[model samples]
Every structure is written in structure tokens, then in C-alpha cells.
Target chain A: MLARLRWTEFGRDPGAAIARARLISTLGPLIALLLASIFFSIRTDRFLTTENLSLITQQVAVVGVLAIGQTLIILTAGVDLSCGAVMAFGTIVMTKLAVTHGVNPFLAIALGIGVCLGFGVLNGLLVTVLRLPPFIVTLGTLNIAFALTHITSNEETIANLPDPVVFFGNTFRFAGTTITYGSVLAVALTLITWFVLTKTVGGRHVYATGNNPDAARLAGVRTRRVLLAVYATAGLLYGIAALVLVGRTGVGDPQAGQSANLDSITAVVVGGTSLFGGRGSVLGTLVGTLIVGIFRNGLQLLGVAAIYQFLITGVLVILAVAVDQLSRRRQA
Target chain B: MSAVAARVPVLEARGLVKHYGVVTALDGADFDLYPGEILALIGDNGAGKSTLIKALSGAIVPDRGEIFLNGTPVHFRNPLEARRNGIETVYQDLALAPALDIAENLFLGRELRRRDIIGIVLRVTDRPRMLREARAHIADLKINVGSMKQSVETLSGGQRQGVAVARAAAFASRVVIMDEPTAALGVRESGMVLDLIREVRARGTPVVLISHNMPQVFEIADRLHVMRLGRRVATITPASHSMTEAVALMTGAASSQGPTKG
Candidate 1:
């Protein structure tokens, strides 16, 4: 009798339906993680070590930050193909300001943030004013940002980053497990994003605008302002992530993080945020990031070559999208 | 009638004309909207009821007309202007964002921002206050909402209409116009909405309801305006005419007779 009532309640609520869908999507990654961990644990005693867990956290930090931005854009029924290039641009700007201009490192970080915001504004204006599809707009910006990164940096790595900035990444600890500042930042950001998405008015507006723009307009949401704000915020987060990436690598390389945009989007989608928008969570994206982190880590442990890793990632993206399409059809 | 008892109509349109290219959607339409009255605008589909409402609500510019507000000529350049001038329209779509919850939907356009007279900071939302007010306001209208935090997409057809009415009433200064608020609702839900319309009218806010349901029109409306072929056929008291007479006037069968007397 209790089971029957629960089923009826679930049938009546779309929120419940969405919750159920999220749960189902998570099963794939959770099972994969478990099977891989067990296989590695039996084959290699080092797999379950605290040191390996710490390594995974540090490695996942870059992709995890970018995925948060992708999650926001996807929730708004848009995509930002320029994210990876934007990170490269941010690094280039940060390096130039710090190395060439001899600016304070903290001030250089601020300058890098400003540059990303400007790029975001350009994208927002071009998309909103010109009425271009976000995909096309971001695609154009991607090439532009990529070329500009090279032009600005002269295709060279800016080495010997200021000690203060590197310190931000190098700080380490072990509290039941090894953790770094980057991982801490990533986790903190994920939590903050979860709160904002679930608890704030502006966040609700994002969902509304993404779900149905016409309805949101009539509701007087100021959708244009909201869209511009989302893009700007994404750029700012990308800038911060760029800072972390540069510090983590201990060098500002223009070509580094070239695959960030694709990897972030893959994590977001795999975590169950629909590309069509109106439904998702930051927690899901975290899980998605972990899946990627573990998959890469486990594959490397299995002696798979780095080139094969790219092919596998490509196949997984296709599989994830196909699953999403199928689930949408089922729901409809 | 005593002068105090004889209130000047809040809104009046005289010889209102509207044209869409070669189409004459409304021609010389006349309407009088009195304060504290539930006025029903009824007609067959495409009988220019919408065109006339659009003109009154300032959604479309009238080709030729004189709209008088409180006995003074007024021209609204846009819907926002009309709203400022005490005219609010709830379209058939309700215009509520589905992903947002009830509180956000209610305060979407004209949100109350915090005002600090001194150096003290303020949280504008005042969630507790807004929630309490929203809850009390909907209860005053006597509509049942499952929860204030539930998204609009979770609302039923009738409940959504109630939300739309509540939103219009909460913000509108003088007049609230509902375009087919009951057309999509169930029988009981339609009855609930009609009851809310009566409550709105009792509060001395004039309501201009556009509905096709004759029973609903007769139930809530104090005065009925019939439109036929882009012209006002007649305006009559509901108590003075049966539903049959109203429909005949609406369909143009009794256009020459004007409003049929009891």
C-alpha cells in the first residue's frame, strides 16, 4: 500500500520525475567507478591509496571548474564553445601583465578577470543584439580568442610564475585524505553554485528564461540582463580557473587547457544537465567530473595510451548524448 | 440618482476604431467601464472583442477613438503606460513563468526594492514577509494553492488562472482585465475564478472580463457588452436579459434592436 501511494505521488510531480531521472543517470557512473576501483584495488595495491585519491582531486580541479560554467550555459539553453579559448586568453593576459609589465601578481589576476569579463560582454552583445545563435557566436569567438591568445603571447610559455600565485596552488594537507588548494576551491565553488541554483531568485529566472523565453519575458524577468549576467559570471569563473591552471602547471602556457571547453561540456551533460535546459544540478556535474577523472586515471593505470584516451572520451560523449535523447523521448 | 451614487465610469471609449492593413477589426466601438462593476465583454470568435480590448489595454494604437479616464481624454502609448494609468490586462496565456515559484511570479515586473533612509542595510526580498503577504493575499481571494514555493508548472489549470488573477489584483491600481480566465479551467475551477472576480469587484476595482461562457458571464458580470462585426451591439444589465438575448446580440441577430429590454 505504501509503495502504491509513493508511485502515485511520484507520477504527479515533475520535480519527483526529474529527481528519479537524475538518480537513474547517476547509476552508470557510480557502477563504472565501483567496478574500476575494485578491479584496480585487486590488481594494484596502490589504487586505493590516499595519495592516489589526492592526485585525482588535483587533476579534476581544472575540468571541474570549467564544467560549472558549461552547466550554467547549458541550463540557459546555450553553449559556450569559446570557454577553452577564453581560458587560454586569460592565461595569456595574466602572464603578460605579471611578466612584461611587472605588475603585482594579485593585480594581474584582477586584470585577467577584467579581460575575461570583456570577452564575455563582447559575446553577450554579439549574441543578444545581433540575435545570433549562441553556438555560432561562441564558435566565432572561439577562433578569435584562440588566435588572439597566440598573438598576445607570441606562442610561448610564460615561465617562473610569481611565488605568491604558485603558493595558492601548492598548499597541501591530509585530513583522512590528501587535498590541495585547487581541490578545495573546486569543492567550495560546487557547493556555492548548488546553493545559488537552488536558493536564489536570479537563479530561478535563469531556469525560467531557459525553459521558455517568451513566458519568462511576459513574467517580466529582464531576460536580456539575466543572459548577459550569466555569460559574464561564466567568464569570471573561467578566469579564476585559468589562474588555478597556470599556477598548477607553474607556467602560463597559451596552448594548455585547449580541450577544457569540450571536456567541461562532456562532464555537465554526463552529470545529467540537459542541453535543452530547464533541469540540472551542480552535484550532478561534480559526479560527472569525478567520472571523467576516474575514467582517465583508471585508463592510465590500465596502460592505455594518451591518444586512445581522447578516442574513448569522444565515444563516451556520444553515448551520454544518446542516453539523454532516449530519456527525453521516454519522458515525452 | 444621487450624484455620489452615480459614479463616473472609470474608463470610457467612444467611436473607437482599429484597422489592420485592409482589415477593419473594430469600427466605432463604444464602451463605458464604471468603477466597482464587473463588466463582461462577450461575442463570437473574431467579432472584434479582442481588437477592442487591445485598444483599451493599450496593446494596439487605435486608428480613431477617444478614451476617457476619469472624464479626461487619455492615450496610452504602450501596455506599461496603460498599467501606469490604472489598466492591467491578464492575457489568455496568463503570462506566468512556469519555472519560477508563486512569489517570484507574483512580483516579477514591479518588485519592491528596499529603501534605506539612513545607513542601515536592507534585504529587499523579506521572504517571510513576502511569503506571508502572498499567502494571505491568495487566501483573501479564497483560491487554494498547494504551496507558495511550488513552481507554476506544478499548478493545475484553474490554480494557474487564480495566480494570474491574484497577480493582476495585487499590482493593478484601478482596473483588471481578464481575457478568458475561465476558458481553460474545469467547471469547479471556473466557478472559483468567477467567485474571485466578484471579490475583486466588491473591493471597488472595476473588472473587465472577456469570456465566451454565457453562464459564467451571467453569474459574475453586473453589466454585459455585446460585440458584433467590429461594432458594439449593446450594453445591458445581466438581470434584465436572459442568456439567449445576450447571445443573439453577440451573434448580430439583434444588432438593430440594440439591447433587448426585459
Candidate 2:
């Protein structure tokens, strides 16, 4: 009798229905990732090889790191269009300072990261103090950072980076496959971010601020501070992404990462993090990065044209957003 | 109840004034909430009840006012300060994060940390403990919310109100001020909220209820502090006045000489 009552309760409970919806959202990307992997392995003989898998991880390292920052900003219902430009600028700062200006590599790295942090703070202050929309603020900074990168590098790629600068790009054999330190760093950062978002008070505040800023403020949350912290933290991650980029290419290419801003956003969206904010996980972002990596790599092995990758990714992004909107409408 | 005037008011305000350009929201409004009583604050549309409540709850800084808690003058620069001083408020919108779960919403700003080093050094929240305490609080109020882990957006309107009230009830050490908590609820849900208010008063914590519902106010409030033209017009109990008289005082249809002392 008790079991029957419990079953009826579960069937009728709105909370149960909502919980099921949440589960679907959280698991959707993982299932897609696995299915895509299986499909690729069947289509292309080289798709499952460790060499190609390692290469995909290596290729996604820089964008994956940038996605971490993008995920943080987007989780707060904000976007950073300047993340890629800021990262490109940071690489120039680190590589030029170390190779041309002959500053200590570590200090140059710190200075590079510091510059990104400043941009984050600048974006944050403009959003909070000036009360500007994040999209407009970040859009303005994108051009500024892009111009700064060109001026700093003088439209030149700085090469012959110091060993420490390229350390993350160095390869190490693991499980009979070559893996880059940059890939390891990207995964590590994702794990740490996942822990922070799930286990910390600041994480909760971020979600709350994104969900409803007025409600958060009335509940005694310093929503401005929370937003500032999120942007600044994202800036710090961008700086780290700059390091990974420099290490991967062994040069500071001023022209690199031009499309990375949208790419990182694509990964976040595809991974199941809502563009509207207040509901997402960084772990989902990791899965999303892999999904993009797999699709591009798989298509390449299938002898598909490069431009089709862009078309497919664009379609995936729209589908993810539509799903998010549908789920939100259901809840409403 | 007649002898309640001898005790110092738990929360008191005098000559509070607030202006938004040409519009004056609060013009020298005075308020008093005694210990362990549901004080219903009633007024017409533009009578400045919201502005007065904002000042008392620290949502806004009044242009001129003196607010006292237990006879001690207090200035709250923000809602956080008011909350720190053991005053909790449920705004008209409920002020709850819809995406957060029940336990998370219950302890939004003031989350509990584990006693161990992981929580201390890493600043991790004690989720298990918060969930347990949240369940206990909800159960104490006799609200039948199925799971504490369900996000507030998924809950029914009444359940969401229950979470807000439960949060205020759990943390409010001195006073709980609610602004039209039952305005959006159905009759049954409103009855549940009224019972919750009475239960809070029975627990010896005072409540300042702002509502336009005359019958609910008459049924629950120990005293009615009527407002007209941004000032306290009278303080009448259900025993001394009818709902018709209360409405008259609220809408300026009847004249009350001054704020009547018990």
C-alpha cells in the first residue's frame, strides 16, 4: 500500500517531472558524445586510434581552456566576446616580453596573465558600475584587445619561445600515446572549476545572480561583487589559455584564435550550459569541448570539406539553444 | 493583549520620510511592532506602506527617520545589515532564486560550512547539513514539499511561498516582516500562510504583516496599524473596531485624531 502511494506521488509530482527534465539536460550531451564517438569509429578506421585521439585533445586544449572562462561568464548570464582577442594579446605579451624584451619568462607570464585580469576587471566594472549590458561591453573590448594584440606584436609572430613558455606544449607518452601538458592543464582546470561551481558558496551566488539579480540582492547577496568576481576569474582563465596557446604553437601568433570567441561559446552551448545562465555545469563544458573536437576530427577522417565543420557546429549550437528554450518554456 | 503597551516595542520607527523627485513615498510615517504579536500594516494604494517597510527592512534609505530595535536606535544601510541584526523580510515578489534548490534557496547568502578543513580551507558548503536542517524547518511548518533538492522554479506557487516563509521563519531571530505574502496564493494556501504567521507569533518571534485582505488581517492580527497619507492614522484591534472601520481609516473615509495609543 505504501509503495503504491509512493508510486502515485512520484507520477503526479511536478518536482519529479522537473527533476527528470534536469536529468535529461545533464545527460543529453554525454549520450550524444558517446553516440558520436561510436559513429565515428565505425565510419573511419583511424578515428579510434590513440594517435588521432591524442591529437584531438591537443587541438582542443587552447579552446577548451578558453571555454572554461566562457562557461564562467555565460553561467552568470554574461558573455565575453573579447576572450579570444584578450588571449591572443596575452600570448604576445608573454612571448614578446620573454623573447624580445628579455624579461624573465615567469614574470612575463605573470605580466601576461595580469593584463588579461585587468581586461576582466575592466569588463566587470563597466558592467556593474556603469550598469552596461555585458554584450556591448565585451564587444567594445574585443576590438580594443584585437588592436592591442596587433600593436604589441607589430603584426608579427614571435617564435623561438623559451623552454618554460612552451613547456605545456611538450609531449609526454602516457598509456602508449602522446599527450601534451596543455591538454592535461585544460582537463585539470575543468575539474577544479567543476568543484568550485558545485561545492562553494561563491558558485551558488553566481547561479543566484544570474537567475535573478534583484532577488539575490534582497537576499543579502552582493551581486555586483559576485559578477565582478566571475568576470575577473574568467579573465584569469583566459590568461592561462594564453599560456597554453603559446606552448602549443611555440610562438605568439597575433593572427591566431580569431574565431575562438564564438568557438568557445559554441562548446559551452553544445555542452548543455544555458546561454540564459543560472543552470549549467563546467563538466558539461568539458563534454561539449570533446563533442566539437570529435565532430571536426571525425569529419576530417571521413574526407569531408573543412567548411562543413563550421556549418555543422553552427547547427549544433542552434539546436542546443532551442532545447534550452523549450525546457525553460516547459518550466514556465 | 491590552497590557502589551507597557512593553518596549521590538521594532519602532518615527517620522520617516522618503521622496522620489516630486512624489513623496513616505512622509513622516511612524510604526511600532510589539513583541510576539502579528502587527498588520494596512493602507491605501499611495499611502507609503512599501516605502516605510523598505526603510525598516533597509531596502532604502529614508530621507528622515529614526528606527529603533528594542529601544536602541539602528541605521541599516542595506538589507544585509538588517538581516545581520536578525530581521528577515519576505518582499512582495518573494525574493527567491528560482533556479536554486530548496536547501540552496533556504541558505542562499548565509550557507553553512562544514567543521572540517575541506570546508574551512576550500570554503565548501555543508550541503548534507543544510539539506537536513531545511527539511526540518519545512516539516516544522507542516509544508508538504516532497523533496528539498527540487529547484524552486519547479515548485507550485504555494510551495514556493512556503520556501520563502520557511526561510524567514528559520533564520529570523528577532522579527519577520512579510509584504503581501498571500496576495498571489489561493484561499487554501492563504489559510496555510495565516496559520504559519500565527505559529511564528506563538513561537515568540514578532511578525509585521503587510496585507490588503481585511478578513485575513482581522482573523490573525493582534493589532492593526492603519496608514493614511503616509502617516500612521490609528492603531486599532479587531475587538475595538470592525473591518469596515479599519477600511475607513485606511482610505481616509473616517477621521482618526492621531495615532491612538493603547
Candidate 3:
């Protein structure tokens, strides 16, 4: 529908050329994902099976949710290095309250999300009020969240979570293949976020703020408020990611998600969202997350070493960013 | 033109005093903008012309001053407040989000929301309505940017200026203050902006234009407000003063003939 609208409006509008270019850019990640899947399928019959495909979706659930939040932050030309640690802290809070502190399961979940929201607000206040660089502020909060997670959980893993906490982790059969509710939630959240970003006033402000903050401010956008809302909203998404994490692992492990910060960022960049901000889409991010999942699954199926996967992922990230820079230069 | 002076000023400022910690940017500046006239504010680089304009447009709060809109004292806490009172300013930088389309830029801060449940619940903007209105606004100003959907960055320097001016003209019911609207444009583009200013005045909105381009100022402005040493030194009409005399008054080389009045 969007493409049709663009094409219909293309008459007598020279801007259609640029709009076409953007459409191609958005499709870039999906193309890469399809090609990668084809290569893996050709290499190993196991790669094409429903079992392995469902496994990939299950594996991507947590990181997929994390990437949603990451996409929002990166859209504002900001990065949240604390997202992974914040999710870990939230998971611990939820599990500890329910299992150890005997808090109501629903209240425990809300409190966990609230704690994550608080951190987001704190990050926002420091960035807007003190006017600190986002990199430095998030870096500080990253360490703070990491420390708090360990302190609260006592460097231990909490298992046997209540039913409500583990609800999303449970599997349901769909078309003869098992699917986790967490995966559905991740995809749902992505669509909701995409709607909010594309169809609302707040979404436009996010793009405007990222594109040129001074201009946005002069145009009557309360840019500081926009930034604050973005950080706070991203933080809330991270807390939801924590729930997905607990569901998948069935344990609140303090040591989990140590590499998640970089992983989620990798997904966003690979999905074709610009790290410079204001130009990418969450739908692209969905493709990006799958791309990462496919590569890891494909490599493992092909008997590549676990360590080799890290090397390949690193190379992919740099390549994606290089493509972004080249395209930006061309636009300039 | 003489009858305009007898009417109450649409926008007026008295003794606007602003200091920046050991440096006074605006020292007791007084300004008056009458209805349906182009008042060009001209001053040298450090003569505090921008500072005085900022105070009136709500970009900065003056330490000591009173501003009146339609004879009613008004204090603007920010640019949005000024805008709510029917005053708009086009900053020197143009303040345009380059990645956003011209229609989006026109409705950047003050987007129109849909009136239905979709808008009420989801807060979805009335994008189609905004696009229609934006096209009308741009067309009314006779700007030929081709498409309202094109991002501002894709437009040429002159086209961007047209977008900025058109925005001010569309929303400003009482006054439009433009700070060097043509400083970055080519000669042809500058002339187009001067025409835009004239078109704005034709619609009965008074304009407060800040320009260093003396010829353009004299060509379009009805009255010239010359600032020197952080205050209005003289208010002269093009009929009464030459370009050389305006420059001299702006640089403190020539003294006013008498106490300055609007």
C-alpha cells in the first residue's frame, strides 16, 4: 500500500527518484537474508527443515526484542550500551521478587519493568539536563546496571520461575511446527513500533530530532522532550526483552546477555538502519535480526567453529556500516 | 505610510535589556513594528541586531524588558509561545530538518492530528490533510519547488528559503520576523525572497526583516530601523535617508537628527 501510494504520487514529482532509492535501501537487508538462506539450504538439507527454522526463530526472540529498542535509540542518533545490562537487571528483579521475596507474580513483572523504565528516565535526565554525550552517559549506566544486577542476584542464577514469568517461553504448535510465544511477541512489538514510528506525530519528531536537533528545536519541537521520550520508551522495550530472556532460558542468569549489547547493535546496523540515525526502519530491523540468526545457525550446521562465528559476525557489521557510509556520501 | 504611524503598533518592545555575563547583547533596546509595513532592522555585526530580534521572537528572554502585542503586554517564554501569539520568526540558519520532506518541515512542530478515533486513540497525524494544506500554502506563495514530498535537503538554497518564508507567512496572523532570509541565496533567489516578503505584506501581515543587504532593504522596506551600540539609533524611511546615511547611522559614524521615534 505504501509503495503504491508512492508510485501514484510519483507523477510530476522529481522527488520520486529519491523515494525510489530509499525503497531499494529498505529492501537491501531482505535480499541479503533471502540469499543467505538459499546458500545455507543448498549446503545442508537440515537447514531447510521446519525443526531448524523454528529453532532459529526461538534463538532470535530475545535479541530480536532487544534490537527493537536499539533501533529506536539509533534512530535518534543515540546509542544505549546499557540496554543489555539493564535487561539483565530487570530479569533478576522479576525472578528474585517472585521466587525469593514472594511478591505477586504480576506485581513482580511490573516492578521489574518499572525499574528498567527508571533507568531510562535517569539516562534521559542526564543527557537532556546535564547535556552529556549519549555515549559517555550510557557507558556509565551500563556499568551501573551491570553492578546492580550482580548485587541483587548475588552472582547466582534464579530458577523455577513462576508460571506467569515463564508464559512466553512455552511453545505452541503452529502448522505442525512448534513456536514460542516470545517470538510472536517480538514480531508483534516490531510491527507496533513500526506503526508508531511511521504514522504518529511523536515518530516524526524522533526523525526530525535525529536529522538536525537545532533545526528541530527552532521549529518548535521540544527536542529534549523527544529525546527523553525515546530513551524512556527504549528502556521499556529492554525490560520486555528481559521477560523474553527469562522465558527462553527459564532462569534469571546474571551472566547472560554479556555480549547482547553488541549483538543487538549488530542486528540494527545489519538491518540497514543508519547508526547516524533518522533514516532506517524497524521492518528492516526484523530482517536484520533474522540475518544474524540465519548466519549463526547456518555456520553451526556447516560445522564451523563457534569462535569462527564471532569473526564472521564482526566482518558483517563493518561491511554493513561501510555500505551505509557509501550510500550517505552518494546522497550528499 | 504616515497614517500607519498613527495606528497602534502590531508588535512593540520597550527597554529590552539582555546581558551575557560581562557583555551586554541588548542594552535597553526599543522597537516598534507597525501593521502592514516592512520594517528592515539593519546593523553591523556586533551592533546587537540579532540579539534584539531574538528577544522579540522568544528565542531568549531579556533580563529587563516589556513587549506588547496589539497594545497588550506579553511575555514569551519560548519561540512556541511567540508563535501561539501569532508571531513567527525565520532564523538565519532556516531551521529546516534536511531529511524530512517539505510538507513535513512545514508542519514540523504543529502537526494536525486526525479528528477521528484513529487520531484520538493512536494519535495518528492527518498526513493527507497536512499534505493538501502544505501544497496550498506553498502554491499561495507562488513557490515552485515541484513537490511537497521532496525532502528539504534535496531542494536548492533558494527553494529552502522559500519553504521557511512560506511557513512563517502561512501561520503568522499578525507579524513575521525574518533574519537574513536571503543571505545564503543567489541574486535571483534573493529577489524572489524580496517578492515573497512583499507578498506577505500584501496579505496584511507586518514583517520585521533583519538584513545586511542595503539595496534589498531599501527596495522592500517601508521604514528602516538602524541599531548601533546595542540600541536603536534612528528610524528613517528610504524617502528621507540615503543608503550611505543608513550605513553611517548603523556604524555610529553619523548621529541622528533628533530623538528617534517609530
Regions of candidate 3 where Cα sits further than 4 Å from its true position? A1-21, B1-3, B258-262
**Every model's Cα RMSD, please?**
5.1, 2.4, 4.0
The CAPRI-style docking tier of model 3 reads: acceptable
- Residue-by-residue lDDT tens digits, candidate 2, A1-332: 44234323433466666677688779999998999999999999999999999999999999999999999999989988999999999999999999999999999999999999999999999999999999999999999999999998899999989898888999999998999999999999999999888898888889999888888888878999999999999999999999999998899999988999999999999899988889898999999999999999999999999999999899989988998888887776
Rank ordering of all candidates by DockQ, starting from the highest? 2, 3, 1
RMSD of 2: 2.4
Q: What is the per-residue lDDT of model 3 for residues B37-109, given as tens digits with 9 covering 90 to 100?
A: 9999999998899999888989999999899999999999999999999999998875798789989999999
Find the 10 residues in a row with the least total lDDT in model 1 chain A: A2-11
After best superposition, candidate 2 residue A132: deviation in angstroms? Answer: 0.8
- Against the correct fold, how does model 2 do in TM-score? 0.96
Please report, in order, the local distance difference test score of every candidate based on alpha carbons: 0.78, 0.89, 0.89
User: Model 3, residue B35: what's the lDDT?
Assistant: 88
Interface RMSD after interface superposition, each candidate? 6.2, 4.4, 6.9
- Candidate 2 residue-wise lDDT, B155-238, digit = tens: 767778878988998999999999999998878667767877887888788999999999999999988888888888889988
TM-scores, each model vs. reference: 0.82, 0.96, 0.94
